[model samples]
Target: MIEVLVVVGPGLVADAGLLEEIAAREFAAAGVSGTLVRARDAAHVLSLLSPSSPEGVGCAVVLPGRSAEVRSLIGRDLGAVVWVDVERADGVTAAAGATHLHGRGIGGLAWGIRHAVHRVRHPSRRIAYGPLPEQWGELYLPGADELYLSDADGPPVVMLIHGGYWRSIWAADIMGPLCADLAGRGLAVWNLEYRRPDLHGWDATTADVAAGLAALATAHGSDALPSGADGAAAPDLTRVAVVGHSAGAQLALRAVADAVAGEAAAADGAQAAEEDARAAAGEAPAVDGVRVAVSLAGVLDLVEGDRRWVGTGAVGAALGGRAPEGQAAPPYGDASPLLRLPLRARQLVVQGAADDLDLVDFGRRYARAAERAGDEVTYLEMPGDHFDVINPATPIWQATAQAITQALAAGPTSRG
Candidate 1:
């Protein structure tokens, strides 16, 4: 028994009875039985939408009269009841001799409701594969990060880090589709959620990731293993490959650099100072003994980022406000994968040609830098925007999937 509630705006109050009659007919046509509730204003609309109602509608159709009010109501009841906004026509004709709804009307309103309903019922599908048992937990791991685990028995375990300029608003759920894809390919996937720089700052997020990886390795009995290709013999840690999107790519690169720097510092008895410096800089020391790192539209060059318009907001947001004027370029330059290239592990960078945010130049620059540093870097450019790379329906996403699958199948290789 699907139920829908239509909230008419004040402007339509004069013809409220007529509009309600039209909506009732439309609902019957859509195979949904519902009642049209006329509200005096946006406030009255909210009152009707409160959780106290017993009918508990499955969806709500709102005309665009009070858009802000509609949005607020939807925000409060998301996942509980679907919301759709209707556009009205102002009597403007298009080439087809039909009036278009730019701003009052039943046609646009009905269309929006139907579209929303379809989306709610038919979300993207994901398949899970591998032998690892599913595990779920929330822990205050390294850098005081919140971690959620989904484990399976597979040859290689993949870690997915979402990109949001390292902002807190983004979560592991953003990578859900991607993780599902990797898992379906018979790989154990870990979807990691870390503290955003906005909440705990950059260092904390990095610490959380480092800790989470360490926890993952320890749980799988791979912590004591030696470094190198042969290290794949260790328990569930056969081969560690990280897939990071956007700023997550920056985090992944920093993780690798910190690993190398940690070893160097430890060997020279400079570990404490190094740790202090890392803390001050809002960065983690890095994960030790990773085999491969794949970055998707990674923002490697902060200086380049500043020069360009794409990711400046993200960088500024993550860095706790714009870098001070003439402050030696804020650690973003040093942290960029381009500057740290000649990376120890084999690297693959996949970028979208239509990605307006990161742009193609960033990936090209990183590739050039890697080659100059004698690092083995494979760059794959495909058509589509930033989000399309993870969207299964897009060809670019399929290409990325193939690249990852091939890399995993080939195992780790030496660039030198």
Candidate 2:
């Protein structure tokens, strides 16, 4: 029996009563009992989780702003923390080891509680690939027998890259539902939280994605992702898919291209030597190991996006300047997924016909360009919006999921 604790922040007392009601309903639905505690600050919450406290809290549902307060208790056998309404500084809270739920407002509490229960039952791990606070990913593993979506080797691994037009305010939490859904379907889910371009420079964002995928490739036998629960086999990294939504599609496609290029360079000793020299000069290495890349209503063309002032100029802001005129140059040349075609890896490009005209246009063009460049591409353009593709319950996402499953089943094709 797990004892859940719902902690309300002092500043959020107005919603305390509603929080209690929702907690009760959620607890009942989860078949768990909980205690709602009104705390003044982090110190008060800490005192409640202390050994001297009467209530044994196995899973905690914490409010925003105070999530960092319980950071010290993480990985200390204190229990899992589900931080709700996360934003901005919440990235640190997530890095501190709490499962964060953002942007859903009061509705996020429902998912937060669900996440806490999953953590207590399945026991996911948040492993950091880099020393920075934002360079970490949470691995969610499903029961072995529950793998309805698995192949002969094992469950396919899917790394989710969330997108908020590459803004810092949009962390990995937005991908929570999708992560949970994929895991429930028996796919190992890696929900990554990276340093966004807004606060940590564009290069940092791209570097973190590459490094995160590299970590996933070796996660099977490493401490980064252990066989969960009953020692179920780790996910088959050899058959991996990178799924990105909205702006994340850009990162996903770019990473695939970089990896393919990296592999080719590695095979050529002279090219590898040059790349090593470039690495010594501080250029980060490209990462490999992804078999398929899925883009959901992705902002795939940086030049077009910047030209359209999409996301109110989010593309330029993320790439650090307007699209280079005459010829693609600098950030746009390397950062734009459309500019880096023939990604080599199989691609599933999904776009909503009703999404922003720019995104739909970009998806259509990118898919055509990729196919022209001799890459395997499946273009699925349906009726939906930007976010409909992310919602698991939506028809758009169901079709996208089926496409991803098919792509992963096909396995990796030789780039040569």
RMSD for each of the candidates: 12.3, 3.9
lDDT values for all models: 0.58, 0.78
Return the lDDT, model 1, position 147.
16
What residue pairs are clashing in model 2?
A: none
On TM-score, the leading prediction is 2
Return the TM-score for each candidate structure: 0.58, 0.82
Pick out the ten consecutive residues of candidate 1 with the lowest summed lDDT: 139-148
RMSD of 2: 3.9
TM-score of 1: 0.58
Task: Count the clashes in each prediction.
Answer: 8, 0
Best by lDDT: 2
Q: Report the C-alpha displacement of residue 394, candidate 1, in angstroms.
A: 1.4
